[model samples]
Target chain A: MSGAAAFWRKYGVLFKSDWAIMMAYRSETLIWMVGAFVQPLVSLAVWVSLSGEGSIAGYTASDYVLYFTAVLVVDRLTRAWDVYELDRDIREGTFSAKLLRPFHPIHWSINGNIVYKTFFAMLMIPSWLLLAMFFPAMRIPVDMGTIGLVILAIALSSAIRFVIGYQFGLLAFWSNRATAMYALYEGIHMFLSGRIAPLSMFPDWVADAARVLPFYFTVAFPVDLLTGRLADEPETVWIGFAGQAGWLLLLALSLRFIWRNGLKRYGAAGG
Target chain B: MIHVEGLTKIYRVHVRQPGFVASLRSLFHREYREVAAVDGINFDIPEGQIVGFLGPNGAGKTTTMKLLTGLLHPTSGRIEVGGFVPFRQQNAFKKRVSLVMGQKSQLIWDIPASETFLIHKEIYEIPAASFKERIDYFTEMLDLSLIIDKPVRQLSLGERMKCELVAALLHRPDIVFLDEPTIGLDVNMQEALRRFIQSYNRDYKATILLTSHYMADVSALCERVLVINDGKLIYDGAISKLIDRFSPMKRITLVLGAKIDTSVVEAAVRNGGGRVVAYDYPQLEVEGPREEVTGLSAKLLTELPVIDLTIEDPSLESVIGLAYSEGAAGESRR
Candidate 1:
């Protein structure tokens, strides 16, 4: 078989195994999703109350609802817990099995997250639709071209965030404070990635920084693409795709760099 | 199938004293020292040979195993397993080798051992028919039919280890590294695992390198043993030869029916060219060279009111323990 086919074949088995594990902890998963939903839910409430049925900084109540719901779903789908997992694995020697595998450990981490997010989405989509029925503002603005571009953007966004989180997770090879490093990264990401507020609501400099930096490309840009923030200008939406692609390329390169160096350190540590 | 020449690994460790003041002081100027975990060890094993690596804790056995399996890189020298440089970690090289650490588990703890087997099947690309056949065979051989479907966390240590070995060998790797594969197992469990390992060697002709402090594991399975201490290879030869070289004394035990004077028993043993190593009225123990055991036993039988007597060679535990201390002392002096 070709290498690509072999990769997918292996991935299918890995995904199935992880899906079983997720299913066994279905209740715990629901509880965690409840916590995850609170962020976007509160953001929507605050924006709606402040807007008073009008527009706040070019965002209508309806726009705020759509943007925050999209953010919540996208964030859930792209979440990475590898920083803590890697830290614990390295310290406890659980990483030995992963390192001994013929494939890179990141593939396993990625596969596990894919299974978890797919399960979470399967559980959450119906609730999202029910909420949309109760509140018309929560309904998504869908189009064929927009859906195609948004799908590409979400895929790239997931890849970019996964690589970034994985690269930070590799810090555990050198120091015990890898989780702290990830938290610091997430602190910066929250403000710039529009996890706290939409990029349009940020100060002009912060918004521009989010655009030039990779943070907005991961969360806000994809959320905006889905909400038709770039609706009128098809060219701008395409440009956003190009920006996300560029960041994905950069993060992918860094992931490789971090992984090669991290393995050397990990091997030296005798795990 | 496996060869090593001057293989070495040195770990750079940071040293720190344990106080808040010392910790603060270390932040600016840290002290580092290089400890050689595997120091220039050399050995070779042809295909189908199961060589036991014997050592005390903190010796280089595990480090050498890790280096051979490409889990850790060597600082110097060369290692070739199945004609491939192990540290390169090439896909073909990896697929041909396997490692099993008794203290570490590769199975998914919350899932059945069979789940891990399926994952390995995908990773190794084992044929579907062969995977089924092997699973059935291993389940019967290891008596895992009842436990293979249970979650790993729910299994006993020995049962989990049984599952671990099956998972590792499912791919039929040509080069196997087993580090203390029966560390905490019962005697029966250890024997079962040893039989499986021996059978694997016989059938596949795979080069097997095993490390265990348990002397029974080495004596039962390996013909040639590698004794390492202080990160150096001290003795590499047959197990019997090691016993002969390091321990030549034989022990004899007697069960006296009536209480005998300790002095008389000691005197009788001394005159027979054996010393009373232990004595308690009705029981006496003597140690002597192999050549003197027969003469001494006969003399003790005739001279003392001995009810029954038995003789034995020195245990492997003593011979190996002596080898490690003597070898490590010698290596340090050099």
Candidate 2:
């Protein structure tokens, strides 16, 4: 086997190990799932009440339900916990052991995250089907072309989010409280990624700004693809993909830069 | 093989006083003190040799181990393990060496130690046949069959340590760096581990560098010991020579058959040019020069009803203590 093939083989083993670990904490996983679904559910309910007896901001109550539910599922599928893992490892000197290994630490962390998200998506599918059954507007246009693009967008978005979170996590090598910085980043992402409402609901300048930033590409762009918000506009779809690709490339470069600097700082900290 | 020259590690430790005001003041202007964790030191060990690194707490033993293992980069030094610079952490270099810290663990806490063993097999990319054979060998040697399947959190300290050793050695690396591997083990467990280490070294022809405060570990496993104090090498030679040079006085213990006057024995031993260190009902411990001890033992055998008697040198513990104190006093004068 080639080098990349061997790496994937090792990654497959790690994925299995992560699956077992996640299963061991099934109750905690369920609690996290509930927590995740509740946010979007609440947003959908509020929008439904706000659009009572008529459509508000060009979105019917059913549309609101579908959009928010899609957002919830997409968010759950793409969430990355690398920041927390990186912070803990750097702080406790656990990263020293990882550095001893042959492969880079990020590859293992990403594999573990992907495994966790895949399992989580399996659990979320039933809820997704149930929500779509009751709300006709929640139904996605299941064409092969759109489906392929959505899948590609999901892949790119996950990479972007993972690298972004990893870069923040690497700050622990230099900073005392890196988790606090991550919390700040999460706060900004909440509003910018349309977690509470669609980016269309924001003012023109704010929506334009969100479109230009990477946070929106993580959730809003994929949700747009699923909810038909970007339908009939191939240019917008291409732009979404381009933005994700650009951010992925930038974050990857930044992740490499921060990782090198962080390792140097870690060595200074006695590793 | 391992080589190190002029290895140095300096840490910028933040200094703060204990008060809210001090903490507030430190926000704007912080004080930093440079601590020399490892000063300039040079050593070389050939492959397959088990060398003991002896030192007191905070004497740069762990620091040196970390440096050699590439966990820490030296400020100004050159180190090579198996022809690869450790700090570079090349894949082939990492594959050939392993580091085991007794106080810290690499095993997954909520899972069985076997899981960690499997993970390490993957990480090291060991073949299935070789991995299985190595696991079987370690399991048998370390007596890990019973505890290997249990969750790491459920195992006793000694059991956990044994499992850790197996996990570390399963890869069968050519070089092993063990830092305080017998810190909290009971006597029997320590003996078992020491025996396993010796056998592993001999069987694999692996170079082993071990650091520990337990002198028994050094005495049993290492013929050549490197003693470090205050980030400096004080002595590097055979363990027996160290004991002999540091502890010139020999200790002779006698088991008396009958109750004897302590003062009489003490006076006689003093006159015979030996010092009576301790006296109990049936036993007496005397310390003196070798020749005087021999003569005094003969005199005591003639005088007292000696049921049993034995003469021995001071233990490694006392010898190292004396070495540290002497070294400390000498440094103070400088």
Candidate 3:
């Protein structure tokens, strides 16, 4: 088989294995889901209260609910914890086993993340449905064109975030405290990705700065796609896709560069 | 096959001292020292042979294993395993070899050992039918059926080690590198692992390189041994040769039916050209003068009340200790 074909085959098996492993710890998985969902739910509640009696920054109370709910789903779907896992693996010499494998270790991690998100999103859908039942405003348009764009944006966002996180994880091969650096990266990501609020709600300068970076493209841009924020201008929708593509390419290059350098250092340390 | 020529690995270690002042000083001016972990070792092994890598702690056995498996790169020299440069980490080369460390584990902690086995099957891309056959064979050989389904965290160290061996060999690699594969196991478990490794080598004709502090592991499984000390090869030859060369004396322990004066026995053995090595109540141990052990034994039988007696050659541990002390003394002299 070709390398790509073998990769996909191995990835498929890894995904299934992670799924089974996750299933065995269903309660812990559910607790983690609840913890993640609570963040967006709390944001929605706070935003709704702040928007009482009038729209704030052109977003009504119901729009805030929909936006933050979409934020939860998008965040959950694109989540990548490979940095933490890699840090643990590197420190404990478990990475030696991974290095022995025939395929790149990142492929296994990506498969693990994808499988985990798929199962997590399944559990999340019912909560979304129940919330939609009580709040009609949370419903999005069923237009096929916008829905297709949302799917594309989501796929790119997942790939970009995964590669970016993987690149950070590879740093563990060189440094002892990779998780600390990862935490700092995530702290920057929170504000730049508009996790707390829409970019428009931020100061004009802040929002403009975030636009040029890739963080907003990872989370907010896809959320905007689902909320019909790109409906008025089809060209801007393509621009969002372009941003996703550019960031994906950049992060892929960064991941490759860091992995090579880190492997060199790892060889030295182990030798 | 494996070839290592002038294989060397150097480590740059940062030196630090305790105290706030020292820590502050270190931040501005760090001290670095170059430690040679493996210094220019050369060896070659043909296919399907089991070679014991014997070394004391920090003698670079594990480092060499890591380098051979592509987990590490040598500071200098070249190494080839299974006809490929190990440090290059070629996919085909990796697929043909496996490394197992007894102190570390690869099995997922929260899951059954079967989960790890399945994952390995997928990672190695074994055919489903072949994977099942291998799993069946390993399970039977390792006696893993009873514990394979239980969570790995719940298994005893010995059981986990058996499972670990099963996991390592399921891919059916042509070369296997094992580092202390029986470090913490009891005697029975250690023997079982030794037997499993021997059978695996015999059945598959796989080349094996094993490093263990346990001399029994080498004595039981390996015919040839490589003894290293202070990052240098001190001895490399047959296991029996190592024992015979380092240890020139044999031990004989005798039990007396009656309480005999220990001094009289010691005097007799000393007079007979044998050295009295140790003496306990009702028992006498003697070493040296192998040529006269028979005469000494006969004389003791006729002159003293003898109950039972046994003779033993020097053990591998004693041989290794002798080698290390000799190496230390040689270094001090230089």
Candidate 4:
């Protein structure tokens, strides 16, 4: 087989092992799932209460439900905690094992992310279906074209988040408080990604700013695309895709730059 | 094969002092010290040779091992292991060598050893047939048939170490670096491991570099030993020569079948210009110049009612201790 084929075969094995380990942590998964679900659920409740009998900023109670549920799904699909995992590996000297291997250490995190997100999605989709069953207006149309676009957006969004998280993790090579930095990033992401409310409910300037920033692309843009916010505006939807691609490219470069420097620093420090 | 010259590693450690003032002051201005962990050590091992690296704690033995294994890049100097610069970590170089740190493990904690072995099989790209054959051979050799399938957390320390050796050697690397492979093991386990290492060396002709505080580990497997102390190599020669140079006196033990008077044994010992290092009841130990061992034994056999008298060199432990003290004294004088 060719080199790429061999690499993917190895990746398949890594996925199998990682999936097994994730399955072993059933209680932890449930807790994380609850944390994931509760945030969107609370957001939905707050937005619905604010809407009361009429639409708030063009988002009716049912539209708010659809948006937050999309937020829940998109957020879970794109979440990356590679920062914590990489931080622990670097701190505990376990990364030495990875360095000794022939392959790059990032492959392990990549495989883990795929396995974990797939498992979380498998668990969350049923609950989402159950929620939509009781709430008729919250249901999304089963349109194949829209589904394809949403999947593409979600893929790009996950890559962006993963690279950003990994770059933050590389900070551990120089600073002990990289996780604090990641928390700060998460705080900004929360405000900008429409986790509090739909961007349409925000002031005009804030909504415009969110559209231009990568955090919005990571969470809100994908949710909006799936919830039909971009359905009627073909040009705007294409612009959204361009923005996602732009940020993904930029973040991928930053990941490479930070990783190169981080490995140099690590080698210099004799880790 | 391994070649190293003037290999050095210096670690920059931040300095701090107690008290709130020092801590606050250190936020803006910090102090750092460059400590030389390995200072210009040099050695070369031809293919298929088992060379022992002997040193005390914090004596740069582990540092040298790390340098050789590419775990740490050297601050200065040169090192080539299996014909590749270790720090570059080229796949071809990594494929030919393995490192096993007794205190650290590469096996996954929550999984069975077989799972880890399979992972290694993929990483090393071992063929399925050879992988199975090697696993079966190693398991049978290490008596790990019962424990290979068990999670590593459940195995005893000895059993875990045995599995570790198997994991490391399964790829059949041409070079192996073992740092204290027998640490925390019982005598029987140590002996078993030593025997296995010797067998592997013989069968594969794999160049072995081992570091251990257990002198038995060195003496049993390494004919040539490199002694390092305080970040420098003090001696590198045959183990027998090391003993000969550091410990000039031979030891003779006597187990008398009948009760022999202490004075009678002492007189006979002194006749051969030997000193009685220890004497209690029927047991006696004599220390003397090497040349006199034959005559001393002769006199003891004839003069004393001895049932068993064995002549041997000083233990490797005492010889190594003497070598270290002598190196320290030399350092002071210099």
Residue-level lDDT of model 2, residues B51-107, one tens digit each, is 999877788888898888887778898999999998787889889888888888878
How good is the docking of model 3, by CAPRI class?
medium
Off by over 4 Å in 3: A1-6, A267-271, B249-318, B327-334
Residue-wise C-alpha lDDT for candidate 3, range B1-334, written one tens digit per residue: 9999999988887798999999999889999999898898888889999999987778888889998998887899999998999878888998899999988887888888988887887778888999999888888888888999999999999999999888888889989999999988999999989999999999999999999877788989999888877777777778886766567777888888888787788777777668877778777887865566778777767776889988776665677778777663344221
TM-score for candidate 1? 0.90
Give candidate 4 misplaced runs (Cα > 4 Å): A203-205, A267-271, B247-321, B328-334
Better candidate number, 2 or 4, judged by DockQ? 2
**Per-residue alpha-carbon lDDT of model 4 for B24-48, expressed as tens digits?**
9999999999889888888899999
Native contact fraction, candidates in order: 0.45, 0.48, 0.62, 0.28
lDDT of 1 by residue, A86-115 (tens): 888876667878777777788899898888
Q: Which stretches of candidate 2 lie above 4 Å from their native place? A: A267-271, B248-318, B328-334
Cα deviation at A219, candidate 4, in Å, is 0.5
- Ten contiguous residues with the weakest lDDT in model 2 chain A: A262-271
TM-score winner between candidates 1 and 4: 1
Using TM-score as the measure, name the better of candidate 1 and candidate 2: 1
Tens digit per residue, CA lDDT, model 2, A1-271: 6777777778877887777778888899889878888888888999999998798777888788878878888888887878888898888787877787777788788888788788887877776677778867767865768878887888888888888888889999888788899999888898899898988888989889999999789999998898877788889998888999988888788888887767766742331
